[model samples]
Target: MTLPRFRPRGWVAATKAAQRRHQAEAAGGPRGPAPRSQRAALYVHWPYCEKRCSYCNFNKYIPRGVDEAAVRSCLVTEAQTLLRLSGVRRVESVFFGGGTPSLASPHTVAAVLEAVAQATHLPTDAEVTLEANPTSSPGTRLAAFGTAGVNRLSIGLQSLDDAELRLLGRTHSASDALRTLAEARHLFPGRVSVDLMLGLPAQQVGPWLGQLQELLRHCDDHISLYQLSLERGTALFAQVHQGALPAPDPELAAEMYQKGRAVLQEAGFRQYEVSNFARKGALSTHNWNYWQCGQYLGVGPGAHGRFLPQGTRGHTREARIQTLEPDNWMKEVKLFGHGTRKRVPLGELELLEEVLAMGLRTDLGITHQHWEEFEPQLTLWDVFGTSKEVKELLEQGLLLLDHRGLRCSWEGLAVLDSLLLTLLPQLQEAWQQRTRALVPGG
Candidate 1:
């Protein structure tokens, strides 16, 4: 699904506003007491890659002669600045996402972690994850990353079939992926996770299941199975549009998804969220924080963040986006101590939309306690209980609302987009009514 684009005011205006607010709060102005200390997650984006994948549309580039030291220093500075600005006193988790963060030097990783430690309380046992490609990560490199305090490795082994790998425009061969998985397992043990893509063009159900089963034998406790999506402007999308390659089949894709879920369940892997499966004690803490709508800070180029700034009332979250281009981001950090491009406070409707969108994807769903913590002034029933659409969904066995709070049935998860479409309008109307009732002259 395509997200709505937001055109924020210029950075200079936003920066000046933020400074004024911070200064007012510091001087004990009308904003009241300082925001209570909070724990948040951290995401560091590595914007460089060795080769661009055909199906990728992330903010990454195959650069020409990058100064690694300079980039490392910029990342460190941004992390410190943002943490201070947000008044987040503790970090719950850290993720190094990328254009293959494995390409970054171990010293760079250590430096970023050290900066985080100095800025906030970084627990020794906090989950630190790094994304790696098989072509770039070897045994020695994996060992070095482990020594640098990365407790988990998310290896992008998209496929075990050489032809499929080539079609996906991945640089690593099947052998290379297997070798890297072995080496990573040796170093990180049960903390390793593998990402596999299914639903390739003309991919049959039998071969897909076979591939999944084969990987299960060698994979560690965690695996993420994703369906191939041909995003616009991607090479694969262009090929399919030009008739150079076949488009993926939606019907076949649905069949594969169901069968794949069954296969993973039989193998003792729990489908904690759509596209993610893990054994007991191997769930991704960093991603779980995201699905729970917990606050997290993003510090690298083109990274996005959501958190409550100091002195905000209630749980309203502010959205942050860093500069997209690497060099430009570094320059901005040097000038302002951060590379922030936009910092917009989310509205009530926007917050509700994000909460439902992310929370409903998980098995735990949106719990009553979580909802109250997020918005103490309103109860879950006030927002959703009176809707006829919700009643119909409950009657149709598509949704459940026991004491555990609202969640989708297995059948509902397969058609989550449609279900959300049915539910969001009701939520918006309810929220609007609440807003009107709270106003003095409504």
Candidate 2:
């Protein structure tokens, strides 16, 4: 089955006027509705990479004679600006995602962490995660990162086969990946996570399972197994479209996913999100906040964020995106104190859509409490439970809604896109009815 991909809409960088207005509002002008919660997650994006991967479509560039210090300063400044704008005083987690955050100097990481701590109350035990590429993270660098306050290391191994690694345009060999994993485990112990990709071109289920089994022995508590998605505009996409490379077999991919889940289960890992698996007490707090639709601030080029606008007067949330180009982003930050390119306030339906899109991807579906927190005006059942489609979905074993709240069943997860296509319209109609009811003379 072809699962539909849902990308959240309404992201653009902030205009100068909008930036000024946002600043003015944040400075204690007229206050609006506060966010559902004040505690938030922090995401720091690093936009530079040592080499471009064939399948990556993220906003990243191979730097040439770049000013690293200036970039680091811009990141710290942006983080401070965003923290003030968000009015979020407590941080639940901090994630350093990137073009390659592992490429950053330990001092740079420490600087950003220090700035965050100064602006907000980052708890002593908060999860501070840094994404590392096997090639960029040597043993010494990993140790330095640990010293710099990065407690969790998410290493990108991608594949364990040397041939597959080359085909994926990775600079590191299979041995390099293993070596890095070993070093990371030694340094971080139980705090290490490894990312692996399945569904590569011409990949067979047996061989893929073998690679997974091999990784299971070396990996730490968490494992993020993602199916390779050939995004449009990526080199892999171009190659497949041009018939130079064969596309991955969907049936084989599905088989790999199912079998891989079993393997992890046997190894004592629980599937938390659709793509994320972890042992007890090893779930990723940062990613969990994301799936729960909690507020987070994004800093650096092309980063995206969702938070309650400090001065907004309603339950609506703001979606923020940073400037995509590194140099331009820094320039904008220098002028406006942030590189925010656009700030879109989500409507009720949009918010509900986001809630479902993110929440349902995990085992903890949308709880009644979470729903009420997100949109206090309506309950989960009030919006979706009354629908005929929902009834059918529940009867068909594709959805579960009870005291635990609404979530997809195991069968439903495989076809989540199809399920959402059926449910989103129901959400829109429900929200519309709620709006009309709130009118004085409706």
Candidate 3:
């Protein structure tokens, strides 16, 4: 498969902006949204890797002849700047996601952890995680990261078959991945999760299951299975563009999702989210905070965050995502202290659309009561003809009306796009009404 070879300029800017924000907060300015009743988690995106994965499109790059000490210092300053600007004292979870967190020096990891620990209101039981590529740092990176204060580790073992790995354009072979997983079991004292990808260019059902079976033999309680998506602008994407790499059929991908879920469920791993599975109480709090619409702060290059309103405005929320590149990021950090923040504007209708989009994907559906937050907006939508669409879906059993609110059934999940179209108009009307009534101007 051909890869995306063009340098991403937007990502570079975003990375710089994000780095600038972190730097600012570290220098004694307020960072993310203010802390309130609802606590927040922190996601530090370490945007450097040994090599860019062919299928990946995230903002990351291979480090060159750069000063490790300077970059490391910037990371510390950025973290501190965010703490001051946003006034976030406590953090529930701290996730170290990256091109390859394990590739980071152990001292760098320790410093980052220590910096976060000093931040306000960090949870005592904070779930600190680091995403590590199995091959980047040889054999004991997982143990090293664990020793550096990372309690949870996510190993990027995209596939368990050597042929599949090659097809996916991954660097580590299946055997190397297994050895890394074995090492992780002995090194990390907390829970460990393995990432697996299905729906490759030539993936088959039998071999995919074989991979899952093999992974189940060694995984530490949590596993996330993702369908291979050919996002635009990646190397794999270019290969598809040139007709060199084949795409996964949507129907086949759906079938694979079902199979993976069944196997993991049988292995005692429950599907907590669409792509996540875990044992009892093992679901990732950091990720669950997202599904539940909880708050968080994003740091480093290309990280995303959500901050909800506090006190009287507690029901409302806001969100932001950092810039994408790493070099631009370090420069910005040196200049402004933290990356720039792009606040995502949200409205009542958009919120419902978003809530439904994320909430429906999980096993636990959103409750009807939460809809009341936008209840003031839903009047005219009630008068519209589209109201019948909801009734029609209810009559057809495509959705359920239990105490957990409206949720798509297993069959309905397949036709969610169609369903959303029918509900969008009502949602839009409701949003306008709510804004007019509740917002100051209306």
* Weakest lDDT window of 10 consecutive positions for candidate 3: 1-10
lDDT of 2 by residue, 292-319 (tens): 8889999999999998867877667899
What local distance difference test score does each model get?
A: 0.84, 0.84, 0.69
Model 1 alpha-carbon drift over 4 Å, by segment:
1-37, 312-315
Model 3 alpha-carbon drift over 4 Å, by segment: 1-38, 137-139, 308-318, 369-386, 413-418, 433-442
- Per-candidate TM-scores read 0.90, 0.90, 0.81
Note the clash tally of each candidate.
Answer: 0, 10, 41
Taking the tens digit of each residue's C-alpha lDDT, what string does model 3 give over 12-51?
4324443443454466644454334346777787777667
Give the Å error, residue 237, model 2.
1.5
Cα RMSD, each candidate: 9.2, 9.1, 7.9
TM-score of 3: 0.81
- After superposing candidate 2, which stretches have Cα over 4 Å from the reference? 1-36
Candidate 1 Cα lDDT to native: 0.84
